[model samples]
Target: MRFCELTEQEFRDFSSTHELHSFFQTPEMAKSKQEDGCNCYYVGVKKDNKILCATLLIEYKGRLFKTFSSPRGYLIDFRNKELLNFFTNGLKKFISKKGGTILNIEPKILYKERDMNGDIVDGGFDNSDIYNNLIDLGYKHNGFYLELDLKKQVRWAYILDLKNKTEEQVFNEFKPNTRNIIRKAIKYGIYVRELSLDELDIFKQLVDSSGELKNFKSSPLKYYQKMYRTFKPLDQIKFMVAELDLNEYSLCLNKELEEYNQKISKLGSKSDSKKKEYQTQIDVLTQRLEDLSVKRKGGDKVILAGGMFILYGKEIAYIFSGTSTKFRNFQAQYLVQWEMIKHGIYNGYNTYDFYGISGDFSKDNKRHGLYEFKKSFGGNVIEYIGDFDLIISPLKYFLKKLISRFGGK
Candidate 1:
């Protein structure tokens, strides 16, 4: 087998059929990285002119030398020990030849099979051998962390399996409260529409507002524009925002209120519980109608929430998302999620990924709401093997580490 540089088409042809390929490992993502001043290259191992394994290396400038990362790592079978060794050696050589100090990789391999609550399944399939293989090959283990590191990959993820399931089945699997929220959004006449490229600023604003509320900084608008320029034409990215047409919703509420009044007037049965339930609903609707009148004075339409979806391989990932705090009662974010989940089911994808959750599952965890929200959709938690750093030059790598320790660029 020979390790060589691959053309864009060569890489695409091989990755299109590879079992481990994800959106991150694509040329489109490489182009997006290029927009950020990162150099991108594709390298792979081939035999008999057939490509076997590949990676997209993203090169970033380091303090003393160039550093690199292979996002989602190589497209190779981690279970194949021989192949893993070959790919690792080739990557190490490739980076060293480029005058790099350290190489970072986080493979798309699961470390252990886990259940819904982030617990290891009983005697479930595991990838401990691959972990050991990486260490034996001189790749320093980053260790399995149970909290968000900010600088490293959030190793844990949540994925809902959409295989062999109908859209109704998927919807029914959501928790009762989650289902209620979606229904509430529907009742509020919230609907999702795809955002055009020019409208990304609106998405940017919402996400930025949410970030500020949480004491975090959001990506600039151009970051999303660059992503659009790279992935939009390929139909691999989707940005959807939930909207409410107040005038139309007002009509719907008026009709519903009339029906409820008619039912109350024609009440013949003495079911006090049912009567109270209907009356309570009527009162709630009345209050909402009053609120709508005031809101409509400002605008007939309003955007409540939005999200970005990355469609690739057999999964649809709900990656970046945001919502307006003023419309929290509408819960339009849930509407966005439910609609996207149905989209995945309709498209015959294998999984719907609710990306990036803290590993701390405690109730007191500040981000516990994130975990709980994803959990309500009913899916297994995924734990990847984590990252590995291959030091190309020990001395240079040591200096770089020391510089980073002291907050030096």
Candidate 2:
């Protein structure tokens, strides 16, 4: 086995035959950073004509650092112990010759479940998973330092699944009252439409509402517009809206009120139980209807889907939705999600991902509310092995520490 540096086109061609993640970790990104005076390199190891592994390295403060980003450093070095050793040795020599003090690596791989429980499983030369390869390579392990697992890692924007199931399956997925409200919404002519680029002002309204409530960080509208144009050709993205009808809202409200009145007037036997249930239903329905009433002018109040998502492949579709304060009671946000999920399923996506449920699910945790909302959808929560780092050099390690504390540009 041997290791060497690859040019941009060379890496891209190599990646076409391997995983896409390898291409992301190509030397080119590092080289681009280097042109700005940051040292960067792309290195790969091969055996018998097979590219076994690749990594990206950047030089900062005379020390080599590993970025190990997605689709780039998505290292699957697990099965190739001989190649990993060769690669690591090559990295040491390459950086050292350039006056680099150390090499740091952060593999885009997760630690196994039991590995987290403090069991140091032996990594063998014959191991297949790259996570185990890191262990065998004499890389230090810090169990507590971790990030979300890959399976559950949510991209900023995504799609959801709604296929192969009956409408009842869709309805059953929501909170009971939520299901009825959407049905009621339909009865009142509440409709959903795909938003177009020219109609962005309407989408902005929804973005602002969501940003405020979630304290979400976002690029400006120009950023989204650019994205809309850039990824549009891929056809993996779309913007959707849920529009309300105030006239329908009012009618639904009146109809429910009439039903409640008749039940009370008839002295329907078991009147107390019936009245309590009916009254609760009426209160919920009325609140939603009243909320919809505000949008009655006919132009339509829109609830926008949160982001640009990639769904050209893979089974899971992720989402980043937010709601307007004005439409909170109307459950417009819920309806929007319901529609998105249905969209995913209909389009052949298996999972409708509500990304980023907090790892800490205890009641006191800040993310508990989000955790619960995602849980309500009935998918089993999967926890991924978190991120891990590899120390490239001892001297540079302390140097970075010094730079962090004492300050260095």
Candidate 3:
């Protein structure tokens, strides 16, 4: 029932085996954040020489006060009320001693049971007790949010369970349209490959284009490069891109066009109805050929879509993704995701997380398109408990909020 600082190895050993472990709690991630100018601390609660709870606290120094955040952390069994209370009280005191004015946590526990469409499941497993415990322990609950705003971590995500399942089993779970789109990408000769470090520029460009199209700002190239360098060596990260092999696709289209032409020629001697049918087929094939030719004339290969994924514990998280507007119909994004899912299955991961989505499932919500796309993959929508702030210095916390509200300098 006491809390103390833990060495990196001690923290990693506990976190790696914890059910709620995430890559954000890893030493490498902490090191990367440290390099980005945040101070990282690993603390654990223990008794009888066994750890019960742990977290990676990131110290952010503001101009006036310091704040701490445990990104998707506070690795503890939330159901244990006593343990939760002890950790909260101990953590507040510890952070206060270090001059921290605020402690923010976004635990990776589910808030409630949610169906695939982001609707709550009635009479399902509820974590209200756990939520109440945190609030009762003096932690201020941040309101449940649906939009992708300034929260340290996303509130909603889509996760596909891959444990004890075959590739066909998982593929069968996808919606019919989703399956068709993946097949279409393959038929169109969309090639997916793992990108090397030197090729991250391709991913950066894809992400930048996506941000521009979505009207959101993207991280600079250096951020992704650092992440790759930090986690790639441990075989914990994968950067994948889908490309259209224009020449090969063009050849396939040309071959199909020739076969259709041959059929049309043979149908000339048959009934007019048969001839008309073959002519219609020819027209479609001919137009597709023309389109392929135009595309091939530009380049042999064109990047269509790319995504970055992180493999930690039992989950492979699809952290970031982007697609090319020019080849939107080609459905390269579907192929990219299929490749990652297959990779996860091959690697024996238990889950494939389509990481973040807007909690607002209403059609009018601007980001609802994201939720729909992830839903098509047949994953359940998950809502986390969201962020909680444990104020260490009420004066500083109040002043900061006041300043933020009035846009103070």
Candidate 4:
């Protein structure tokens, strides 16, 4: 079979038809990455003009870098052992002709098995074994997906099973405090509504504000708009806003409750019987009302759960979520997750990634907050064995490595 590059339109058409295709390897993702600083290309293997396999290729210092939608990586689905030699040999010859260094690939076919909740429970395979096969083909094996499991590699990614679970049942499974926040948000008449392109400005404002607070970078408005344009038509993505008014009655109730609690706390120190009675009544009603409010608001309060969706066909939805800091005490974030899970289950997708997680899980790690939040959702942590590198030219590779090592302080 001959290999050829596929056009953006052809690639998107193919990808949209296959659920197994990862979002990263799609033409749309490649376009985004290109904007972020990478030269991307799309290639497909064809036999008798019928497409057999396709890959999105990125270039860095002459070597090829490939990734599928799951995340940036080397290859998406490099499991066609029969074509391994053909692809590797073709890649080497191509690199040599172009005076390049190497061709590096990390395929998406899991070396391990992952459960529905995105946890790697089984070590399906390991790098050493795969390396041996590559070695036989004169291809160097590089370590990738650092965390390996018999069935699943990393545990952080997950899919919410929505078949039998109702929205209420799913909400009930949340932590007590989280549920209470959703209830309070609802009691205040806070609502979560789908956003439109006209509302793009507000979404961008939220994204920009959030980026500053989190110290992370974001794509331009054009990119987000392009995303909506490309993915929304297919129902593979959506945008939404959760709002609350300051003058709402629940706002006043919240203030009153806070004051009442403060007074009870100060009086309780004296063990006054009258204060105790008032505290008891306040506690019961406050807790009950708060719970009711949370149930009504659903998952809109949670900032992180703002973006949620299931991959429809091969096109996956990128759910962008956020929350106001003013409502933190009520835990709107939890409801955000609950709603997304429900949405995913209803749509039925291959996997639902929580996006980036801390590379290191220690409390001090930058990703600690995200890691903690994703874990509570009850999904498995998946370590994609990490990234691996292969050098085509020993001298150039060594020189580049040396330069990188001592380039700066």
Which residue runs does candidate 1 get wrong by more than 4 Å? 149-151, 259-283
Off by over 4 Å in 2: 1-43, 46-50, 54-72, 75-77, 87-132, 138-192, 197-207, 261-299, 304-308, 392-397, 406-409
Per-residue alpha-carbon lDDT of candidate 1 for residues 1-409, written as tens digits (9 for 90 to 100): 9989999999988887888889989999888988888899999989999888998999998556799998888888776778878887888888888888888998988889999888889999899998988888889998788876656766888999999899889889899999999997787678999999999998998798688777777889998888877888978999999999998889888888888877877775777777888899899889989988888877899999999899998889988888887776777888899999898888889999998888778899998888899999999789989999988889888888788898875
**lDDT digits (tens) for residues 315-353 of candidate 3:** 999999988776767778888999999988888999999
Q: Stretches of candidate 4 above 4 Å error?
A: 17-19, 33-39, 60-79, 95-104, 111-169, 211-214, 217-223, 249-323, 362-366, 390-396, 405-409
Give model 1's clash tally: 0
Model 4: lDDT to the true structure: 0.55
Highest lDDT model number: 3
Q: Give candidate 4's TM-score.
A: 0.69
Q: Worst ten-residue run, lDDT, model 4?
A: 62-71
Best by TM-score: 3
Q: What TM-score does candidate 3 reach?
A: 0.94
- Per-residue lDDT value at 404 in model 1: 82
CA RMSD, predictions in order: 2.1, 6.4, 2.0, 7.2
Q: How many times do residue backbones clash in model 2?
A: 14
The TM-score values for the models, in the order shown, are: 0.94, 0.68, 0.94, 0.69
Whole-model lDDT, candidate 3? 0.88
What's the count of clashing pairs in each model shown? 0, 14, 0, 58
Clashes of 4: 58
Candidate 2, residues 205-324, lDDT tens digits: the string is: 777787788676544666556545544554645666777655565776788788887877686666688778878887877776665656655454445233434343433334445456
